[model samples]
Target: MFSYRVEGTWRRLKRHGWSRQQPTRRAIERDEDVVDVWKKETWSRVRAPRWSVGPGSSSRTRPGSR
Candidate 1:
């Protein structure tokens, strides 16, 4: 494999249509208190990892599957 400089690598990625995602901006009036509460309560319930394989599924699924 060939080594690349930081700028060169980023340029190559961009050339291949892999633009970096822009940072998400929050509203100036966003409430930190509400955000914190949601993180503690709502996020905890749904933040569990989803990558676990079930009994019949492997890392590779059926090759011809859509």
Candidate 2:
């Protein structure tokens, strides 16, 4: 019976020029302008929230009061 080891298989794959990659696929109905707006404005707000209410302020906290 033939058996394969993980390490050996990984080394063989690498030697064959195989690489791990994730290809991003955008939705067919995706809108570039809306995405740009969200990235510029909504992304910041979504990434950081006010009133952390914890030990020390969060570094992700947005500047200025909402």
Candidate 3:
């Protein structure tokens, strides 16, 4: 059977756009807290657009239609 393990810091870094590379177990385990904080900051910068309707709107048009 295959086994997998995750570190708190590594998981956080991943959410912040960090790439995965093979590292010694000790390094990742030691840095979990710092990584988590960075990930949260990075994620918050990502935003989604809001939509508004105007008088010219047509019923046949879809959300993404131009």
- Per-prediction TM-score: 0.37, 0.37, 0.26
Whole-structure CA lDDT of model 1? 0.84
User: Global lDDT of each model?
Assistant: 0.84, 0.80, 0.68
**Per-residue lDDT over 13-37 for candidate 1, one digit per residue giving the tens place of the 0 to 100 score:** 9999998798689789999999999
Q: Show where candidate 2 strays beyond 4 Å.
A: 1-9, 15-17, 24-27, 49-66
lDDT (10s digit) by residue, model 2, range 5-55: 998888889999997777679888999999999999989888756876645
In candidate 2, how many clashes are counted? 0
Please give, for residues 1-66, the per-residue lDDT of candidate 3 as tens digits. Answer: 844467766787888999778855575456877878877886567655557665543557665445
Better of 1 and 3 by lDDT: 1
Query: Sorted by lDDT, highest first, which candidate order results?
Result: 1, 2, 3
Record all residue pairs in model 3 with backbone atoms less than 3 Å apart, i.e. clashing. 9-32
Worst 10 residues of 3 by lDDT: 56-65
